[model samples]
Target: MIITVAHQKGGTGKSTIATNLAVELKTSLLDLDKQHSSIIFNYKRAHAGLEPLDCYSIAESQCRFDGQRPVPEAKLDEFLDLFKGDPKTDLVIDVGGFDSPLNRKALFFGDYLLTPCAPSGTEIYGLQMFEEILQEAEDIAGIHLLTHVLINNADKRSQKRIAEMQAYVKGKPEHFELCQSVIGQRISFKTAYETGQSVVELHEGARTAKLARAYLHSADEMTALCAEIRHALGKGV
Candidate 1:
């Protein structure tokens, strides 16, 4: 399935999820939106340079916004055409922030849109807006929007805000889901991306590999969630 991790605000572990999830499935990644696809650097958290794990069949790269003027609507069609032949090969797209043209393309082309949200008020507002946008877009595009809301990257300060977020999404079953994984706060993820790799690749002898292990398991869970979402709705949901 073509899973697209997108968010209105940046730094919600979109790249990390896309990269590590590909690693979990041993599938290729089509990073069609990120300018850096930070998932490439897997050793940012390591003090000592660490050798990356064996390369998976991931097509890690950034989407080129080759336009002089503002972005047009046809960009979505162009990207969709590239993968029209195959959108169900364990594909993962780390779409850029919500406002980018590539993000629009991804939304139009995505089979399952995975939105990573924090519990902060600002993030909550963004998620609410995102839900509205998705609903309108789905109506316009004539496609079912299977967008899953996964809580991601909550620090001590943010933990207090989840109940509020939970309240906002209390009755929205068709639009949201509380993922089984918490993906608790961790700095290793930011570090790994800064160095062009995943945490698992950074240190097998990780004195503290708990975060890495959680991420791997979360990715596995995401796969199952994607399947469930597809089954519940139709393709291109």
Candidate 2:
């Protein structure tokens, strides 16, 4: 499976979701984003003498683009060609925020496209625009795109707002479906990422009891969410 986490909007936790999912799925990560956040996180994991993410392989394609210049089509093709040779191994791609031919190609190649959005009016508007992009891609490619929208970095206290977001998504069934699992804003996520660890791998001893419990909870939630995504894609758990 080729899973692509993409959005034209930034600060939607794309790296967070892509990294954790890659670790959990034991898949190869193809970092197509210029920021190289995922690659850097893996480097930290290695430098800390941490056990490498089990069965994880990584590749990066760094592209520099000016506002006027289009991303090279050949470059996008080269990165995607990496997956064509290995159909059995799953691949996760982390794309940068910015609409480009490169991103569109990735979207077309994806088995599953995930767009993460925070709970806010502006982010919601971004989601709408992203859905339109997805539609355009599907129309051009003549394929039924399997795209999902996930709520990331939500506050635990904002159940009402979360519900509103869910309702809004439900109203647009043709565009994308809301993910059942929501990722909350928590310090553990940041700490774990800094150490090149997934929430499930975070050591609890260094944290207060309450925070430790929260980390574990997030781990469980992420595990379930990963399973849910796999199942939705008709893959075995």
Instruction: Assess every candidate by TM-score.
Output: 0.66, 0.85
Off by over 4 Å in 1: 39-88, 156-159, 207-237
Query: lDDT of all predictions, in order shown?
Result: 0.58, 0.76
lDDT of 1 by residue, 108-221 (tens): 777667888777788877887777877777787787775777777766466558767666666666667666455556666665566555555544434566755645543444
Residue-level lDDT of model 2, residues 140-204, one tens digit each, is: 98987757888889997998888888888888888688898898888888998998888877744
Residue 226 alpha-carbon offset, candidate 2, angstroms: 0.9
| Backbone atom clashes (below 3 Å) for every candidate | 9, 0
Q: lDDT of model 2 at residue 220?
A: 80
Give the least accurate 10-residue stretch of model 1, judged by summed lDDT.
62-71
Which candidate tops lDDT? 2
Clashes of 2: 0
RMSD of each: 6.8, 5.0
Which clashing pairs does model 2 show?
none
